[model samples]
Target chain A: AQSVTQLDSHVSVSEGTPVLLRCNYSSSYSPSLFWYVQHPNKGLQLLLKYTSAATLVKGINGFEAEFKKSETSFHLTKPSAHMSDAAEYFCVVSDRAGGSQGNLIFGKGTKLSVKP
Target chain B: EPEVTQTPSHQVTQMGQEVILRCVPISNHLYFYWYRQILGQKVEFLVSFYNNEISEKSEIFDDQFSVERPDGSNFTLKIRSTKLEDSAMYFCASSLWGTSQETQYFGPGTRLLVL
Candidate 1:
């Protein structure tokens, strides 16, 4: 079984400050991880993904995440926060298993709030 | 850039009524998928389709739930008898290939409200 746990339900950061959203996972096999962002009334936009290639994966909109196998973590980070960066973030995990092929296991999600 | 699209941005139906949700995936993509997110819950994968057949499905995809690629450009999901618990946002997604390495583009989603 594969599952992801987002450490924070909500995170608030001041504008221009650094931002971090923590996520952890449990998987039996080598897992693929992804970070997706969703704005209000919008679709899930892919921020970044890790497929056993690069440990430090850079994504769109100045966001990035590091895959740490030993720590069982894949936390998203941003050097600076912008107003538009406030959105719902989801950490997802995927691995080959019965009836789970090509399916992603999504976390409960973290609601990010940017303070001006 | 090409992207996936879905119909009926919002739909309201009574319980026990049937509903059909439609999607148009990115043209060059070979895999299609359907996912749903109940209010205040994590997004859940319902089914994955490829080569005109179901490749994978979760436990939530029961006998009442059926999916089809009715045309070259359209994929559809049908719920025979919707329940109050069926109210959720349904998302359609597509990927160039049904591999873990590929990124799946998603549509805006359809908000279903089962009364």
Candidate 2:
């Protein structure tokens, strides 16, 4: 079984400041991690995914995340926060130990609030 | 970009009533899934359908819940005798057959409000 734990339920950041959202995961094998963002009234959008390729993965909208094997973490970051970045983010992981065909497990989700 | 589309974005039903949520997955996709998220809760996987049958299902996917692909284009989730606890946002997603290793495209979701 695979599980993801998001450290924060809500995070507030000022526009133009650096933003970081922490996430940790437990998997039986090399995991495939993903970060998804959901804007108000919109479907979940893929921000980034770590598929055993590169440790540092860059995504759209100036967002990126680093997958650390030792820490079992995949934390999302951005150089600066924008008002439009305010949304709910979910950390997800799949059971690669089960051959990557396993269903995805989603974290409780963290709400990002950007204040101008 | 091809998208997974869901119908009846919002549905209001009384307890014990049956409701069916519809979805049209992307063309050429061979895998379909249904997940639900209660308000302020983590998304829970209900079932995964492939090759016209369920590949996997969770405990929440009891006999009360069912899925079907009546046509090659439409996939539907039916809840028989919905309870108040059934109110939540249900998401339908799909991915190509061999692309199970990739991310699945999700729909905007159908918000079912069981009164």
Candidate 3:
């Protein structure tokens, strides 16, 4: 089974400060991880994905995540908090090794709040 | 950029009534999917469709749920009986391929409120 756990239910950061959202995953096989963001009343937008190729994945809007196999973690980060960055962030994992249809298993999500 | 689109941004329905949620995937995409998020809950995969049939479905996708690509461009999900617990934000997504490496683009989603 593939599952992801988002460590924080909510996080708040001041504008221009750094931001971090923690996620840990459990997978029986090698997993593909992704970070997606959803703004109020908007659909989820893919931030980045980690296949086997890259450890540090860059995503849209100055967001990035690092895949650490030993830690079983893929934590999303940003250098500076922007007002538009406030949204719900989901950590997802897919079990490509199972050869099953790629259905994503998601975490409960972390709600980010940017303070001015 | 081409993106997936869903209709009826908001819908309120009585219990036991049927509801059909519609989506138009990216023109060239071959795989389509449906997911939903209950209030404050994780987004869950309901079903995946390809080759005009269901390729995979989660436990939540029961007999009450059915999917159809009746036309070349439209994909629809019909719920035979609405339940109060069914209230959630339903999202439609599409990918060029059905691989883990493929990125699934999502739509704005339809907020379904079952009364």
Q: Candidate 3 on B16-84: residue-level lDDT in tens?
A: 999999999999999999999998888999999999999999899999999999999999999999999
TM-score of chain B of 3: 0.99
- Candidate 3 global lDDT: 0.92
All DockQ scores: 0.55, 0.55, 0.66
User: How well is each residue in A1-116 modelled by candidate 3, as lDDT tens digits?
Assistant: 78999999999999999999999999888888889998998888899998877799999999999999999999999999999999999999985653445878889999999999
Residues B1-115 of candidate 2 have per-residue lDDT tens digits of: 8999999899999999999999999989988999999998999889999999998999999999999999989999999999999999999988776242478778989999999
Worst 10-residue lDDT window for candidate 2 chain A reads A94-103
Error in Å for residue B87 of model 3:
1.0
How many backbone clashes does every candidate have? 0, 0, 0
Q: Candidate 1, what DockQ?
A: 0.55
TM-score of chain A of 2: 0.95
Candidate 1 per-residue lDDT, tens place, A12-112, comes to 99999999999999999778899999999888999999988889999999999999999999999999999999999999987563223467889999999
Give, for candidate 2 chain B, the lowest lDDT window spanning 10 residues.
B95-104
Return the TM-score for each candidate structure. 0.96, 0.96, 0.97
1 against 2, candidate with superior lDDT: 1
Q: Tens digit of lDDT per residue, candidate 2, span A1-116?
A: 78999999999999999999999999877888889998887788889998888999999899999999999999999999999999999998875542445577899999999999
Runs in model 3 lying further than 4 Å from the true structure:
A98-100
Stronger candidate by TM-score (2 vs 3): 3
